[model samples]
Target: MGQLLDGKLVAASLKEETLQQANELREKGIVPKLTIVRVGAQPSDLAYERGALKRMAACNIDVEVKELDAEITQEDFVKELKAVNEDPATHGILIFRPLPKQLDENAIQYVIAPEKDVDCFSPINVAKMNVGDKTGLTPCTPTAVMEILRHYEINPTGKDCVVIGASNVVGRPVFELLLNEMATVTICHIETKDSSKWARQAEILVVGVGVPRLVKENWVSEGTIVVDVGINVDKEGKMCGDVDFDNIVDKASMITPVPGGVGSVTTSVLAKHVVKACKQQNGL
Candidate 1:
């Protein structure tokens, strides 16, 4: 049987280090502030925001929520976005995505200053990330995945890594991060027929698809390091990961739990990004 990867413990450690640095900055009179630009009142978005608020408060980071009505005009929305971007006191900007169809999502993302884009939503940061530049902030979820590996001292070098899902937010960024670490990467998505065939090849497998328990026991190789990034409520309303924990746990070398895993680490990574942004903007 594989050992459990305790993401809650790992997240606590990461947040502790970040909190120490944040306190030091506070002593120097620099407050690390993150402004969340939320457009609609999405239940899922609200839940995420609540969790983020709790985490940021615990870390002593200031959070400003810029809530706009869903029906607001695109021009006014962009104007509101610029207000936060131009604010010197605001170190990081995390925008809730899937804007009203009237607004061009890509255009709004470009409007955010790259330095203030903590989520790495700006094209400038994306370009820097693609070319393997580590200066810009990485997408928090992917960074959390890397943090998990680092905390566990799991080296990806010379390993065959298979990444399931290919979205801009998690999968693609993770694939790039793994490649940068010298792992041979294969990215599979919804379009990929028989994804299990690819997954069985990985020494390290990272899955981000939202479907609950999509990976069966036969899908994984023995001793493979499984990082389950999915946060889904199963049909029975129990929180679960992409991989079937009970079954696959015995087959894999290590696995991360759903509620206590990547989600917690992601919030900690966001806090870290805010501090980094504060330092950069303060010219420190």
Candidate 2:
């Protein structure tokens, strides 16, 4: 069996550190707050909001969930976003994704102020990340991936890395971070002719393609490090990732499991970003 990279343990440590920072900020009369704007009652959105609130409370951060009607218009959505963006008391803003089809997603993202855009979905923050600026916030999942790597003392510099998936949220940002770390990166997408060809050659492989068990043991080289970012339900209704854990664990040196891996660290990273935004807002 390969070494398991446990995200729950890492996230707990991060939460403890964030809680201490929150207490210190409170001493200076600064309160870190996270405002989650969720439109509609989508089961996934509601579940994520509840989880975020729970984690925020653990970090001693204030959290507010703004539930909007599913019938809300684009104009109204923009107005609500602007209200949260301009609120000095709200240090971080998270707008749940896949809003009702009636609203324009791009326009909605454009309305958020870069400073309070803790999710880093705004174009400004995305641009800042591309330029290698530490001042801008990074998307939580990719940032969490890096945190996991750092926690395990895995350095990507000079390593042959392959990132499967090119979405704005995970694949792209992680690829950029890997480049920043001086790793040789190859980003593969669904359209790629031979994803396994590149995967087998990589010393470190990060899979986020969203298809359950798309990557198997034969796709990876011996002793390679695998990070599975996909959260898909298997045929048996059990949660799994893009990589086939049962098959790859024996061949890989280190690997992260689905439910206990990256998913566990995501909310904690969001809380950490809230604390960082609060510190900057307070000049602390």
lDDT score at residue 177, model 1, on the 0-100 scale: 90
Q: Which stretches of candidate 2 lie over 4 Å from their true place?
A: none
TM-score of each: 0.96, 0.97
The alpha-carbon deviation from the true structure for residue 129 of candidate 1, after best TM-score superposition, in angstroms, is 1.0
* Best candidate according to TM-score: 2
Report the backbone clash tally of model 2.
0
What are the per-model numbers of colliding residue pairs?
0, 0
Candidate 2 similarity to native, TM-score? 0.97
- 246: Cα error in model 2, Å: 0.4
- Residues 151-254, candidate 1: write the lDDT tens digits: 99999988899999998888999998998888899999999998999999999999999899999999999998999999999889999999888899888999
Instruction: Go through the candidates in order and give each one's C-alpha lDDT.
Output: 0.90, 0.91
lDDT tens per residue, model 2, 103-152? 99888777888888898988988888888788888999998888888889
Candidate 1: lDDT of 162? 98
